[model samples]
Target: MPIFHKISLRPEVENYLKQSFMNEEVVSASSKQEAERRFEALLIHLAHPPSFTTVRVNTHLASVEHVRGLLLNELEKQFSGSSVPVLQHPALPDVLLIPVTGPRRNIEKQQCEVIVGAQCGNAVLRGAHVYVPGIVSASKFMKAGDVISVYSDIKGKCKKGAKEFDGTKVFLGNGVSELSRKDIFNGIPDLKGIGIRMTEPIYLSPSFDNVLPSYLFLQNLPSAVVAHVLNPQPGEKILDLCAAPGGKTTHIAALMQDQGEVIALDKILNKVEKLKQNASLLGLHSIRAFCFDATKAVKLDMIDGTEGTPPFLPESFDRILLDAPCSGMGQRPNMACTWTLKEVTSYQPLQRKLLNVAVQLLKPGGVLVYSTCTVTLAENEEQVAWALKTFPCLQLQPQEPQIGGEGMVGAGLSPEQLKQLQRFDPSVVPLQDMDTDCLGDAKREDMIWLANKDCIGFFIAKFLKCKSTEEKVSRK
Candidate 1:
């Protein structure tokens, strides 16, 4: 099978990333040629999904072992009785991992083509079928149940309802059309549901469409680690800023055994609704979803706002999670990114605003975890450095179960300080060729470790509040 094309990026954005990876700290450790090679490899890895698909079990309603058994049975039924082991994580007992087989080269391309947007293409690569809303253009005479080749329009220039497209596209494999072109484009408003039933995809990742809705949450390897790094305790009030569609928020609640008050905040109403839906579907009741901007979350007055609402007084929570917004350049199977340089670098300031509030909201001796799903130095290490300097009360704490590598060197952090940070760099290891034969516990543990590093380009930094009062918020 041929390797995926490198993740397409604007020239200015690409240059900015290359400099971040090959800066003075990075160059001092290695030669310029080595740094450039690693940057190139990262771009390639970003265009492909990880070898293993990760999911977190809702331990509040089900045990990991019980959920694993059911998920394995589901996979067996879906894959025609082929054994696909659902492995439990050693450090994170509630997490499960499924191996994804991919880039199958032997499938013949069909004559009819269905074009989809870049975002839809990324979802297809990650085990989702083409949905009706994602359809960009289809064959002129395409009909339901007809075999059609699906392609991703990487340049975002494909016109909707066009008979054909001449823009740059990539073959994503073949599927049977579930709707006729006439029916799809025939003046139907707000059409929903799958448009293509994928019979053969280049990457054979499992599709969890309404499968074990309450038992499992399909998550990335690094994302699951963020909640664990927070280490929320039962009966303690916790906060999750920017927590819409709360993957981490739900995980935090589960970790606390649903006994704690988990306040989740997001700016958008629809996203907050999704967060509520996920929490309700997972049977996690401790999470309270709110549609409020996190930058304005901290209110100085205590009597003005009602309990269990946003704009709370400072030092109100035991632990806080700032899973700040980011450029999202690290997501896998991304055929292309059309963001300009300004859009790519616009998140650091917003992250700092949230971190400032996160620090104020964390109680003395409380734990706080800051994370992002991006690979920019300005958002990760540089943000960590700024937090430490700006908030003396906040000190970087060691992250347990350190599966990812240490912080990248370009950011001005000392070596020991960098060790406290976790950056899931996919380029640290090459793509794996899984061979499960004769696999013992030891071999399998080693294999899973490699998969952890190859999963996503994420970053996590844990901190502790050392001071109690605002005026006294200073570390010795």
Candidate 2:
């Protein structure tokens, strides 16, 4: 059963997405009813979390089997002897899957209620405890250790420091208050810690907070696929443009066995620091994180010498991964989005700028993978079509272990070109009500399939840069 409401988007934004679904190319291939049905399904799925939680094992530090054992032990302790099966992905060797037992409808709601912000509500759905800053309202006399029902201010209608709220809200689950209502909002200087410890969440997934952080990274399934598709080899000079928090950068270093240099660039200083910290935590020594805008990363002069920093000469990198920053419309457990149509459509220009820089920095015959966690055609398939047209030397390459659907229509891409791109659309898979009684009887392969298709919407396009004939002749 779909417990939450369909994700709320601005009127204009919703209309724009509907048009994309019912575009001429899509309607030509399928009936209008089918397209509209899929669009409606997407809206519903966006407000719910994925059916499974994906964790990427650090194979460089420990084998997948060893990590899996440790994770199972931790989950046993976390769930208090509840048997939760940990399954290894057959296609992705370094990835592990855990089923998220969801929408536990029978959990009793308490008399007292607490309301949290939408972001924190989404986190709770994904197995995170509610932090102090995310608390919007609580029962006036609520005390610590009191079991209370939690709700989310989906439409941002809840006022801070309120004793109670009667606005648009959605029930998340039940949790025990970690602090009294007075302590949480009583003019404290630093009130940053767990405010509510989820005792019986609607979704029963283990929280990975401080749990074997080095051995496993709680990443999305599609994100783990990006690094594999990049296929970074040992001793290759790779550049991660717009890499922040360094998930893929560290993954690239681990994939390369820490043999080659992986230069990670982010526009923000704090994010660059986070990138470095993640690299250190993962024990990867091949990454060098720099705070620089990827758009201005190219250097015009050949004699400019900057040791291992940005503004590098053209063709300096053997491969590149442009996990471009996007509007992030595809993130799940999102009940509402406040962005206007302009904000949603603004990423195409920025992505194009970053791609231009990425192409300039890549060496001939080198591979470049472009990806985004967005479902918009402009930021995804349209960008791919634009890149192929803009860069004469670049050609679309097939992805390995293509688990996602083909590129979406309405991008002006041909059938063959679309087949080479991968788009993970959660709407294709119908939502199945969580069968808690049959959880133990579920097949591993069936669970893996559900995890793949029920994930957040994402897009990936890989390209191989070929040397121009003039350059080839010059080399000869």
Candidate 3:
């Protein structure tokens, strides 16, 4: 029996995605039957978390070996006597991977049930407790300290403060309720903090709530790969165009050893504030964040914006990272998505606009990395084709530590062009719940590679400006 249902999508969205996978090019490359199988597999894998919980060590302040020791000890205390081995990536030395033991056959479900939103349920599967705000519905007579079964309202049909929900719900194991029904629903000051303390989750992954705040960043495996591919050096100016939450921004600063300037830009004030806070927490001082639209980041007529602000002069940055905003259909443990076709297809124009600005802002002989967390060819492969044709200065460059496979074949890209792009497809390999108790070296290595390919669906394309080398900084 399957532990969870495949991700639910509306009929129109499903049909649209089917066209992308079963197009003439894809069907010609592989059989139509095989293309359908991969598409189905993509839906199945998206509904579950990856087999590993990946974290990046802040090598600027603490070495990877030191953080690994502290993290292993903490996992020991949490798992209590089970040998949960922490494996370091051979290609990525600063990355650590801990296997996520999952979908346990036996879990005691409780009679009292609590319903949480789909987003929160996904978080619980990835080692997060249910916060109070995520609670959508609770049983009528539920009280504090009550043992309850948690379910995700997968279709978003559950009403808040409801006694029962009959629409689609998936089991997420059992937990202890920290707040009573009245406390959560009727508390004058809206209730906050953890509402349910997970006891026996179907997926067994350690929660990184307060585990080495400065030393470790709870990041995905492919996300860490982006910074390493950017290859930021000491004292070189870099721009993180759509930086928010500071994952790549801080990683770039850390890679530069905090010696160079990192200009981070985001349009949202609150998100910029959060990324600034994250930079401070990680002890990365090189990142300077500003709330400005990246589409307007280029200064007009050789005029620069205020110093320490955005709208910098053209060819101002040695490197640029355009982590474009997309439909976000590639996130794992996502049970349902209620997006219309218009919303799903709206990212291409915006992505192109940002790409134009990014090329303008990048210095000659500079590197630019474009990435997205969506599975659509429009946002990923098609965008690559568009960028290549639109800008003669931008040339696709190879990536280091290429863990993901070649791009999908539906975007009219040639075999050589597809090979240069990296698309982390979870559907490439069948799902396997990892158990690291008695694994040998060979087995461990295989699992690590699977963990890389079986992660969330993502896309990355690196480019180098092959313009005049008069102003090029010598790369050592």
Instruction: Specify the highest-TM-score model's number.
Output: 2
lDDT of 2 by residue, 196-294 (tens): 999999888889999998888888999999999999999999999989988888889999989999999998999999888888888889999999989
Relative to the true structure, candidate 2 reaches a TM of: 0.98
Residue 323's lDDT within candidate 1 is 91
Say which candidate scores most in lDDT. 2
RMSD of each: 2.3, 1.5, 2.9
Order the candidates by lDDT, highest first: 2, 1, 3
Candidate 3: regions farther than 4 A off = 435-442, 468-476
Q: What shift in Å separates residue 255 of candidate 3 from its native position after superposition? A: 0.8
lDDT of each: 0.89, 0.91, 0.89
Q: Comparing 1 and 2 by lDDT, which wins?
A: 2
Error of 1 at 152 (Å): 0.4
Candidate 2 lDDT (Cα, whole model)? 0.91
Give the poorly placed runs of model 2, Cα more than 4 Å off. 468-476
TM-score per prediction, in order, is 0.96, 0.98, 0.96
Model 3 clash pairs are none
lDDT of 3 by residue, 1-476 (tens): 34777888888888888899888999998899999999999989989998889999999899999899999899998887766878899888989998888787688888899999999999999999999999999999999899999999999999999988888899998999998988889985666799999988989899999889899899888889999989999999999999998999999999999999999999999999999988999998998999999999988765544765778877888999999999888888798898899998899999999999999889989999999988888899999999999888889988997988899887878899899999998998888855444343437778788778889989999999987332333442
Query: Cα lDDT of model 1 overall?
Result: 0.89
